[model samples]
Target: MFVIGLTGGIGSGKSTAGEIFAELGVDVIDTDQIARLLTQSGGAAIPAICGLFGDAYITESGALDRQKMRQLIFSDSAHRQKLERLLHPLILDEVSSHVQRSLSQYVIVVVPLLLETGDYDHLIQRVLVIDCDEQLQVTRTMARSRLSAADVKAIMATQVDRQFRLTKADDIVRNNRDFGHLRAQIVRLHHFYLTLAE
Candidate 1:
């Protein structure tokens, strides 16, 4: 099936865009969601994570201690790489399973780090990037996640720069405006994708 790799920086409205595609009857597989599931209590990745990082990273409820892990990874790139090494393959396998089971004419795999990882290239026919200004990204992320501006900027620093991300997109949706504008672009793209699928 035709696949679109939907990606954008944090707070660039990727989840919103994915929801619009889903509302239009497209299959939307989100890798971040899959990752979350894997790291949650009794998740597939838990045993390995516990073994590798120890029980310190696992909360009393058996879920990942996201805040602690986030701090570690942000402070040390090596820790981030180590965690990615453990999780990326599992996420990819689950994503492939979802794609194969998808019933829609096309699929949108939302990977926030799509361009940075380059692992989903084989699965996507095109790239759809949600674009917004850096300030918007910082503000939106801070507002939604309750992360301080420094924390938001730190996450943004890990992602590919805006211009680089835009340059790689096969299609772009500028999401700095209101929901109506964002939805209008998504509606237009929805129809265009339908034609492409046919």
Candidate 2:
């Protein structure tokens, strides 16, 4: 089936865009959601995580200690890579399974780190980036995640810059405006994708 890889940096509204596509009756497989499920209590990745980092990174409820792990990984790229190494393959497998089972004309797979990791490149026919101002990204992330501006910026630093990401996009959705504007662009794109699927 035709596949679109949806991506953006932190708080650039990739999830919102994915939701819009889903509302348009497109199948959306979100890697972040898959990752969350795999890191929750009794998740498949828990055993490997505990084996690699020990129980210190696991909460009393047996879920990955997100805050603690975030602090460790963000502060050290080595730790981040280690975690990614352990989880990326599993996430990709699940994404592949979902894509194989999808009944839509086309599928949109949301992978926030699509560009950075390049792990899902083989699975995507096109790349659609949700673009917004850097400051807006920081503000949105800070508001929703309760992260400091510095923390938000730090996360942004790990992602591809706006210009570089835009250069690589097969389609772009500028989400710098209101929800109505965003929806309009998505609707337009939905029609475009439908034509492509045919």
Candidate 3:
């Protein structure tokens, strides 16, 4: 199956774009969704995470303490890499299975760190980035996630910067405007992708 790696910085509307693609009959497998499943109580990654990061990183409810882990990883690159090492292979396996089973014309694998990870390079046939200005990313993220502006900025700091992300894109969707404009762009891309899938 043709797989487009859909990625963008936090609050860049990657999920919103994935929803639009789903509505248009495309199979959208999001890595973020997969990660959430892995971190849920009794999830597959729980044992490994607890072993590597210790019990304190695991909540009393037995799930990963996401906020705590996030803070830890942001300040400690080694922990971030260790966490990624534990999770990436599992996520990749799940994504591969989904792609093999998919019946759509194509699939979009929404991987927020597509560029950062580099492991999915051979898996994706194309790269599609949903982009907006950095300031707008902060505003949108803060509003949606209820995170402090400083918190949002910290997350943004870890992602590939805007210029680098745009440079790597096979296609870019500018999402700073209204919903109608966003939809219009998706519609155009839908046709383009359909033709490519042929």
Candidate 4:
């Protein structure tokens, strides 16, 4: 089956764009959600994460404490890589299993860090980037996440910038406008991917 790597910076409307594709009958496996599953209570990555980050990152219920871990890794590169190292393999393995079972013409893997991860390069046939301006990104992210401007800016610091993501894109969806416009773009791109798959 054909696999499309769908990615964007945080709060770039990548998830919304993936929804549009799903509405058009495209299969979408959101890596963010799957990665969460991998780190959840009693998940395969739980023991590893506990070992690496200690008990603080895990909740009493055994699920990962996302906010605590986010704060920890974002500031420390070594801790960040440790977190990625513990989770990436499990995430990729789950993605592979999902892709194997998917019965669609194409599967869009929604990976927010597709470029940063490096583990999924071999799985991607095409890269579709949902893009907008950096200012818009900060605005949207703060609105949706209820994060402070400083918090959003901190997250943006770690990502590949807008121009860089555009440079790597096989297709681009500009999401600075309205959702209707985003939907129309997905419809057009869905047709294109379908044709390619055929």
Better of 2 and 3 by TM-score: 2
Q: Is candidate 1 or candidate 2 better by lDDT?
A: 2
The residue-level lDDT of candidate 2 at 119 comes to 93
Q: What is residue 107's positional error in candidate 2, in angstroms?
A: 0.3
State which candidate has the highest lDDT: 2
Candidate 1 lDDT score relative to the true structure: 0.94
TM-score of 4: 0.97
Comparison by TM-score, 1 against 4, better one: 1
TM-scores vs. true structure, each candidate: 0.99, 0.99, 0.98, 0.97
lDDT of each: 0.94, 0.95, 0.94, 0.89
RMSD (CA, Å), each prediction: 0.6, 0.6, 0.8, 0.9
Q: In model 4, which regions exceed 4 Å deviation? A: none
Tens digits of lDDT, candidate 1, 2-100: 999999999999999999999999999999899999999999999999998999999999999999999999999999999999999999999999999
> Considering summed lDDT, which 10 consecutive residues are worst modelled in model 1?
114-123
The sequence of per-residue lDDT tens digits that candidate 3 reaches over residues 1-198 is: 888999999999999999999999999999999999999999999999999999999999999999899989989989999999999999999999999999999999999999998989988999999999889999999999889999999889889989999999999999999888888999899899999998
